[model samples]
Structure formats: structure tokens, C-alpha cells
Target: MLREKIFYKDELPVSVITANIVDYPFHFHDDMEIVYVLSGSIILKSGYYTYTLKQGDMFILNDRDMHSLERTDEDNMVMMLQMDLSYFERYYPDLRDQFFVVDMEEDKEENLSVLRNIMAEIMMEILQKGQGYEHKVIESTHNLISCLISDFCYVVNEDGKFQNETGGKTSKILAGRLNRIMDYMYENYERKLTLSEIAENEKLSIYYLSHIIKEATGLSFQDLLSYIRVEESERLLLESGKKIGAIAEEMGFSAVRYYIKHFEQWFGMHPLEYRKRYMGKSMTRESRAKYKRCTPMEIETAIHALTRGAFTETEDKLVLKPVIIDIGTAVGDDDNGQPKTAETSAKDPKEAGIFTIMERSVNDILAEPYHLLMDLGETVLAAGENYVITAEGTDTKDISRLSILVYNYDENVGRSLRKIHTENDLLRLVRHYDDEIEFLIRCNGFSGLYRIYRYRMDRENLAKKLTDSLNPEGGAGKRDMLIGRLTGAPTVTTNTYTSSDVLSVRTTFQGMGVELILVDRI
Candidate 1:
């Protein structure tokens, strides 16, 4: 039986908008709208805000928000539905459901495409003029809503706090107040909103307001204000393309020096330095490490870190780039007289079959040649192979490190190798090497030969070697694992091998227990 999906507002009229890419106007709506992108991309303009939409993308706009759309020279199909506020209130019969919202962004290409296809089906029904087009559209919308809500539930339930936090009356009231305060901050952060002014806005004494905020968010009001300023500064730095001095002044910093100091205190780096390093990218380890876990400060730190230096406060320009890289297999041979290769290749399945049959021959020739490298403790990172050394965070430069490429190995083959190595006490050696080495596992490839790489830590020496080694014919099976650490999961072929195959390889670590994580094929 299909379950009825719960949407927040029951009494709201559902206003469906189907438009060709060219007709979309930059207009705001008085009704809550859920946009499901179809065919091509669409632009959504709400009030002074605009968001880009692509195939299968969903955007929810609040009521009375001014929004519009623009057509880009890309794929262009879109569907929009507006929910009447009265309908929502009648259907939900609960005010608590009105304020909560969910947003999801997926990086998994396959999953994203699947969602796009699902949304396309709904759009197709509307386009085809079907008998039950309205019902179908509504049903599809509910399905998408359910999927989104499921994701929201999964994420919030990870900490198991949503029920207690949102279910209690006091918590609900506090949450509403907090939301208002946040809105106020967002609206007036640029202007100085003093503690007394904020307290007056909240109709509470300064002390009580401070205590409540600390209890709720575990941050002092001053620190919270500073956090807001820092966050906005970071956004401006990445988006504005403005000068550091100007950005500091705009963010209400007393002076450039003061901004620099506070910015460094907030992110462990000066604003200019941060902009220089990551004006439009991800954060460094140092910045991520500065904050404690499980707090708004941590969330803010992670946000900045995840965005890296992409949004800079120095420049008031927004530059967001789509990051993509091809995950490929690398194969190489060491000085030993043996050759290393995987038994499959997704690119050429015909070759994969031949390699599969030759596995026994290859195994015989190589004879379990996986050597483990011992971890050299806290070796100051010197240099890495085939990498450009650039400033990372504030003080450190990036190093290209050796990486072990894990291709899809049949579960049986991996287990067999593990078993043979385990009986010979060689698994211990592999673990030791894993601690210092980094492994990149790819499940799409079949051949093991494409997964090998060799490198040293010294950049000057490593670059020469890497250049020589990465050349298609020359670098076969030469790269060692860099800064070896055992990767958590081993990529295994599904429907081909299972954990039963892995259980065949049992071994102990100095009479201690060890757990192995066998991953499902990606």
C-alpha cells in the first residue's frame, strides 16, 4: 500500500506553474512554492535573492517573497508549484510544522541523476496532457517531498535530538525566539546591534538574553555576534572580490588590523592570507582543527572549512565553481621482477574477461607482492611527487603525497590474498604500511595494474621521479603508499563476492582483535 505523504500545509491552494525556459519572469510569489527542475536549468528570483536551478533540483521559497527566473543558455525545463498558506495551515493543523524546513544537496553523480530522472517523469506527465495529470503531479510532488523529508530525518536522527528538541513546548518556544533573533541578526548584522538593543528587541534583560543564548547555542552573545561578522566577512571575502581593507570596514571592524586579528582568531588565518589561499575553495586542516566539536561555532567552522577560501570577505564577489575530477586507475611495477595488475577494467569489459581468467597466472607470477611500509612517526611533511607546492592554510604549503589506488578486487580474490598474507603474518606488515600511506579506492575499474603509484616525500626529488613514473610506459607498479594508513573499507565487487569470502581469512594482531571493513561496490 502506498503511504500518504505529509506536507506541512493542508489548507493552502496548490498553484502549479509550467513554463518554457524563455517565459520565466523574475517575480516573487505570495504563496510558498516548491520548484522541481525538469529538462533544463532555471533561475529563481525571490525578492532580492536569486538561485540557479538545474534538472531535478528542488527549491522552496517562502510566502510573499519576491522571486523571478532567468533562462541560461543551458538545458531548460522547469516545473513550479505554489502552496497557499491557508491550505498549509488547514492541512497541517500544527504551527510547529510550518517553520521547519529541509534542504538537500547531493554530490553523488549517479544518485543525482536518479533524482533528476524521477522529477522528469512528473514533468513528462504534465507535458503529455494526461487524464490524471493533476493527480500525477501531486503524487510525484508528495513522493519527492517524502524523499526529502526522509533525508532530513536521517540527518537529524543521527544525533537523535530532534524529537526532544522540537517536541517539547519550551523547546519550541525557544526555537521560535532563536529563529527571530537569527533573522534579526541576518537583517541587521552589518549595522551595529548592541547587546542592549538586542535585549530590548527580545524583551529580555541583557543578562537573561546572554544566559539563554549560551544555554541554547553554547556561545556568548558577543562571540555569536563576532561569529556572524566573521561568517559574513568570509562570504564577502570569497564573493565580493573586494579589497581586504574595504571588506573589513564594511563588516564594521574597527580597523584593518583589528579585522585581521579577529579574523585570524576566528579562523586561524588573516583575512587577506585566507583570501589568497582559498578565495574560492575549501578550508585547511588548521582552520578545521581550531574549533571544538558539536556546537554552532563548530558548524560555522565546518561551513567555512567546507567552502574553503572560496567566498572571500576581501572581495565582494561570488565565485562558485563546479568541482569535478575523473577517478582513474593507475598501475606500476617496483624494482622487483614482478608485475602488478588488477583483473578487470570497466572501460573495456572484453579486456576484463581476459584479465579475470589470467588472475591465477598473474597471482602466480606476482605471488602476493603487497608490501607494507612502517609508519615513520610525525615526519615533518617535506615534499610530495607530481604536485605544485602552494600555501595551504596560513603557514603550511601543500604537498603532493603518494597514494595507493584501490581498484575493484573480487571479494574472493581480496579475501584469498588476505588469508594467504594473514597465515604468513604479512597482514601485520600491510597494516603497518597502511598507517602511513593514503589509499584511493575506485570500484569502477577492474584491472589492478592501473592502481599502482610510487612517490617520495621530498618535492624536488619526488617530482622528477613522479614525472618519470607517471609516464604511461615508464611508471608501472612503482609508487608506494604515501603516509601509509589503513583505509577503513576495502572496495569489494557486489553479486560476485561477499563477507563469507572474507571470513575465510582470520588472523590476530599480537593476540589482539582486529576488525576489517568490507565496503559495498560503489
Candidate 2:
């Protein structure tokens, strides 16, 4: 089959393409793609969702997902770790379950970034072709797959609904064949592809393949091929200075007019406009301007926790209150599997519904930072207009002295601030708005920083404004804020530093003498 050729014989042995990261149309592939973000940020659009990736992030693309890459900011030097699954199978049969094929039934976002830095370095080392390159490559591949499975397999496994559900015969076979066909189309995108050609290659009657293709993907086989061709053509057009007619001809289109029709039909814009909108942003240019390659110093910083005796009982003393916001289909049993109707479970608990929405929003927002806050469990506070702070020790009495405040962002602010675990985390967040507040205050001839702050501190209207300003969409402000606070000098010292520079802060704040108070800051 043409699909088998793409993966088994032709494109699978060794495929390597290192290019600038730019926006491309939706497309699929038969080979496995191992992409490492050398520098900068990228937005990956696949199927119905988009994934935003940062430097030190790498993702595997298989499952023949129709995805594309977009870079909003420059410096996206992405090292693509593409492998023909066939080679993977030959080289390491045991790793088949690890990198065999993306489970088309599941999403690839979760846990894919586990040990990203290590894997990226391995990939970089291979690209550099140092001593024992072959050995290093094999080792790196081993480590990469091991890390992925160990850290992230849980995400795919736990999200049972998204994973392959047991109980499908024809659907599974049809899906698998469709995946095979899509892979073939991507591998031979620049070559001529016809319905009869694919049908014959799949060893299915032309009539059956036609019906199955349409039924499976909701697009005619011919239209799907045209879509794939135009998509690849779009990538080449934007990434290279190829002429429109040349690109059309190269992709097997009958003429430039036919190419234009397909391109316009798929992208809602002409080829030229589409190229202009998506192209011009290159990984080389962006990475050079905004990102510096991981220096030995930064790598050392990431490895600080690994140093012997570098951390002692005195250093892990910070007790942070972490609040888990429950988000999901908690409001009503809307688990994406049922027909919508006026049901009994829908109307009873309005507050519960609100809590569920807030919980979900909070979870989504703090998804990245929760990793750092794993150990510090001071109190699980339910935050809203009223703050409900709870801690398990008899020392909870003094928690009030710490001045705990809950600030909720406004509805229009784009993000929900309800998920932040503690007032200290919020204070660190406030530092990000320092420049913006300073500018607004100075421009308006405000009396003082406090006066300007008072407006933003308004719980109903201004708090959300500040929250939005601090955590803008796709902005790294919150991360910077968290990093700053985490590495900051706290006002009160729970432990004194010794000459050895090792200190531990006792988290006994929630202990016997501790008190808890909830204040509304916004």
C-alpha cells in the first residue's frame, strides 16, 4: 500500500529536517516527529485544539494528527526529532509501545514535556555530531522514551475517556487504515495522488475506500488529498520563496487556478495573503533575538537540587498554602458523552455550579505552577468573595497575622485569579504589575503608588483589571513573578542561615500557634 511505502520503505529509514518554526496549515504525517524547542515559544494547532509550547519543550507527533505550528513571538529554533517508526521498530523493538504510533484516540499535550530539558540536550548533542555520535544517539533515544513513559504515560492512562475505549471492531480497523492512508498522503504530498491510486494501494475496492474515507474523516478522499497537498504547498510557499504556480505544480495540482481554489477553500484566503500572514517568522531570527541557548550556568541552575548537601532540613522550610480548584464537568454531569436535555442534575445547586466553573478555571490557570507547590501544604482554602481558609494544626490561631487576602479577577479580565493558593503567591504576582502601575500613576499625576494601587485593589472592578494585566494571554509574567518570589528574601526568617549557606524554614506556621484569616484584597 502507498501508506506502507511512506512508513515501511520510503520515508521511514532516516528523515531529518531542521527548519524555522512558522505557522503552517493543518497536516498529518506517517513518520514519528520528535520536535525539541531549542529556543522561543510555539503554538501547535491540531484537530480542534492548539498547544502552546515554550523553550526546553519537546513533543512527539505521531498518530497522523493534522497539526501545524505557529509562533507568535520569535526565537523558535525547534529541533525536530523525526523518526520513521519503522526504524524505531528495527532499532529498538521494545520501545514500540513507547513510540510506535501516537494513540489517535488520545490528545498528546499531557506529560509530553517530562524530562524535556534532558531529552532536548540529547537531541542537540546528536545534531552536533560529537564523539561516538551513534552511541550517543541511541542512548539519548532510550533516555527520552524512558522519561516520556515514566513521567507522562500517567496522563494518557489516567484520562481513560480520551484513551482508546475497549469495544470496537470495524471502527478500530477503519481508524487504523485511515491513519495509514493519511501517513501516505503526507509522505508523498508533493507527488501525484489520486483516489484510485490510494484505493488500490490500500488493497480495498475503490468504492469501499471512498465510503470509508468519507465516513471516517468527514471529508471526501479526493478532497482530503487536495487538502493535504494544499496544506503542504502552503508550508513550502510560506517557508520558501517558491512561486505560487511552481508550488501548485509541484504538489500535483492540475493548474494554478485549481491550487488557488483548494487553498482558498481550506484557508479562507488566497495563497499570497495566507503566505504573508503566516510566513516571514523564522526560528533562526526569533531564537537569535529573544533566546540564548542554554548556557552551562542555566543548566546548573536547573540542577541545583541535585547537588550533594546543597539542600538541608533548614532550606525546605517554607510552608505555602495551596488551594486546589476543582474544575471539570463538576457543575452538571456534562462529560461530553451525553445528549443535552433538561435533566434533574442540572438545576439544584447554583453555588456548586459556580464553584465547579471557578474550580475548573483555576485548575487550568495554575496547571503549570502546581508542580512547585507540591510540598507546601499549609491550608486548602476555598476562595471566592469570601475566603474559607483551613489548616490542620492547633497552631492555626496565628494564620490571621500573616494577612491572608483573596483577590478575584473580574469576569472580563480573561483569567480567573481564584485558583492562586495563598496571599503570598498573590503578592508575588502584584510585583509584575509594578511597571504598569508605575506608568499609569505617573501619567495620571497620581499622588502616590498606594493611591494608584487602591483603584486596582478594588475587589469588584479593579482587581480583575490588575489580574488581567499581570497574567496576560500567552504572557510569561506569572512565571517571572513566581520565579522572583520563590527566589526572594522573605520578610520574616523562619530559619537563620549558617556559614555553610544551608537554611531550612520550618513549615510549622500552620502548627499550634498559627491562626488563619481571610481578607479580600480585590
Candidate 3:
């Protein structure tokens, strides 16, 4: 038995192979494949169907279709054509959910022979690799597909009904019902779901629904649910900056422990460990290093260096002037020095601060005259004009704000342009474009989901324009509008910084984590 191969070589989305074999063990791939018997015969098993493929017989298997074959005749020769679904999707987008039916049992012998001949021609062209062989193979493939559509095949619709009859309506109906159930589960996996609830919604009896689901999927209802949950969790783990616990909760797992247990069982590694391995492969060493966690002093120093001139090692120790804004009086600072309310001090024209990065200790800067300088978390200087600073509140309960402080070196005037209340922990900020700034804010407080926001800066009025949210699932909500989640505050680094074009901000979510989000300036 050979392990399933999910990837193909040579950057080709399609592969054509002619082989002679005695037996082939069960295997699966995330690509559509056609097996055409050129000589002899073979017993093929795919899902619930088992068929004896004689000479000139053809069958098609869809993505994720588990199949195996055993030689019925000694001289078993077959031509297998495998194609990535995404490759065809570019031209045939609607083919995604439609299954190509090629069961020889349901096909006339004459039609089966036509498909076989077309497949043989395609295989020959692929093997010969002559001039214009690629085009010939493609033409032959199209011919075979045309024959299948005209005689042997029928398109399975979204409701699981065959557009053209080839028999097996009952089987198609059962499969369709199971598919609908699976679709429902995928769409609402974030909420608590049960067999009874699903049965009620589908108007099916609990016992019958359970039986059919097991029969159709070869997995019990609970087992299927667990599999879907685990799969979704894996996606979130790699795509979002959400912590393991947050992912477990979002997928409706009873606890993070169960999520970890099932994830490890399916992937052979813990979720966190999987993230690390994934990140190592995807991000470059320089990109990964940009996300290093910097203290408040380090971030402030970086800003100070940028304000003066180009950053250099010798100038890093050069203490610059500090700008202090009296936000405490306007918003009323709490015991931990966070604003008690979410109101911006910019509403009061008189409540702004103006100063420079001074040569003094961070502690000294935080004292009188600079008492209003909040602890900066992540800071970025864009075009050396706009200073975007993310304030890390004293604690998790501290709902912080993102301050876009603009400074004029020649005029010696600094003003807070936008003071938007970030309902969660302020993580990082980077200039996404010339007039836009991006902020990564924590959702469920500290160690939860990290979300990214792109705001267009209004230089004159110091206002922000909400452009778009780019999360796959959708935005978090009005208060958050976070496009995605992260395990924690990521090490963010600016990639492309152009005043006219969009700025690229690359973030490494969590140390040694696999998740990387690239937010582009609008």
C-alpha cells in the first residue's frame, strides 16, 4: 500500500500516468482523477461503489475520493489522468460542486469504448511529449469529456440530483441529504450543534438521520462532527492569529484540551507545534525576526531615531525629545493609567500635547511634564511624518487606544490626530501606506484573537477613514471589525514603504508560530 500523494511535481496541475500493476491499496488526493482501463481488467472500489473495470472502461473519482484497485486479469494496464480541481476551476467555476459521473455500470459498452479511446490518445500525447503535444493532450481530454457528457456522464447538481438521468436517483438523494447536513455543519460550526437539532432542521427523524449519515460518510454523527470541528480548527490555526484556546472555543469544542487531542490525532502534532512548523516553512528568517517583541522604551527609541534621521546603531543611544499629551484630564485615567472612557481627547481642541523626543530615561519621561505619555507597545514611523503608536494598557482590562501622533520637526509642534478606542489590547501598528495606518488589536482581551485594521489618515484634521476588513470568515463586529485573529501580539515589520503605493506590513503571529498576515495599504 502506498501513502496518498497530495502534491504533484514540475509545477504541473495535471499528471498522466500509464502503469501495469497487480494491486493498489486505498489512497486519496485533493484532486480529480480519471482511471481508464487500457488492457485487461481490474476491480475498483471508490466510496460505496465497487466495479469490475473491463477493457476500454473508464471511471472518474472526485477530490477526497478514497479508492483502491485489484487486478482482475494478469495483464492489467491502466491510464490514470489526475487534474487539480483549482486548475479547472479557473475556466469551469461551477464544476466545483458538480460530480462527473463515469460509472461504467451505468454506461453503455459503446460509450465506454469511446471514452477509453479518447483517454488512450491523450495518454499517448502526454507520453510522447512531441511538438504541440500539450495542446493535443488538452484537445483529447476535451473530446473525452465531451463524450462523457453526451453519453456516459451526468452532472450532479447542488441538490444532489442528476441533471440528466443515468439511474441511481435514490443513491444520489441519500448522498445529497448527507451533503446538505455537512454543509449546514460547516456554516454553523461556531455554535453548539447536535444530531437532534440537525434532524429537526432537516425534518428527518433522529434515528433515521443518524443511520443515513453513518451509511453515507462511513462515520457516526458525533465522529463526523468532531472531524469537521478539528478540520476547521486546523484552518484557523494556520490562517488566523488566534490562540489554541480561542480556536477551540470558536469551533464549539467543549474545551481546549479536547481540541488539542483531536488535532494531534489527525495531524500527528499539537496545534501550537503545527503552527511553529508551518511558520518556519512559510516565512523567511528576516521576516520572522521583524516580529521580535520590543519593550516600550525600544519602540519609543525607534520612533525618536526615525524622527531625527535614518536609524543607526550609534544614534540608537541618542536620547531625543519626548512629546507628552494630557489625555488623563480629558478621558480621566484609571488607577493603572488607562482611560476610564473610550472618548478621544482630540474632541477638545485644547487637550493636545506638543514636544520632542528628549534625551532622558523612559522612567524620567513618564514623570511630570511627560506624565501623559502612555506606555507604547509597537511603534512605526511612516514617511517620517506620521508616527503611529499602539498603547499597551496596564492590564488586560485596560481598553486602550491607537494614537496617530503627527510631528513637525521644523515647527516643533506635535498633535494627536486620531485617538480611536481599541476595545481590546493594543498589539502593534505599522504604516500600511502613505496616508493609511494599520493596527493589530487583540479581540478577546490579551491572549485571544488578534485583528488587523486599515485606516486612511487625514493629515489636516487628523481623522481616520475606515477602508476595509479582510478576514476570510468576516469582520468581528462594529466594535472590533477585526479581519482575523492571532494567538497573541505578533512581531510586525514593515515590508514595502512607499508614499504613493500601498504599504506592506508582515506580521509573525506568536513566536515560532506558523501564522503570517500581510496587510496591504488601501
Q: Quick one: best TM-score, which candidate?
A: 3
Give each model a TM-score. Answer: 0.27, 0.34, 0.40
Question: Could you give candidate 1's per-residue lDDT for residues 100-147 as a string of tens digits?
Answer: 322334333332333333344443444454432443344333333333
Tens digit of lDDT per residue, candidate 2, span 1-522? 011123222211343444555654454555666665655678875444456777655556654545567776665655555555554454235443432223323333333332443444444444454533443344334444444433333211321112332212111222222456777877886777777888788677888777766644556777888887876675588779999999999998888999999989876789998778668764222222222244444333433422211111111111223222221112344567653322123333224222443344333322212222222454432233322222232132222211222222223221324546543454444333321100000001001101000111222122333354455546557887665444331222121111101001111111111112222111
- The clash number for model 2 is 24
lDDT, residue 24, candidate 2: 48
Clashes of each: 85, 24, 18
Q: Which portions of model 2 miss their true places by more than 4 Å?
A: 1-30, 36-40, 55-58, 73-79, 92-114, 127-130, 146-177, 183-222, 228-260, 263-522
Error of 2 at 232 (Å): 10
lDDT of each: 0.38, 0.42, 0.45
lDDT for predicted candidate 2 compared with the true structure: 0.42
Per-residue error for 451 in candidate 2, Å, reads: 59
Please state the error at residue 459 of candidate 3 in Å. 54
- Give the TM-score (vs. native) of candidate 2: 0.34
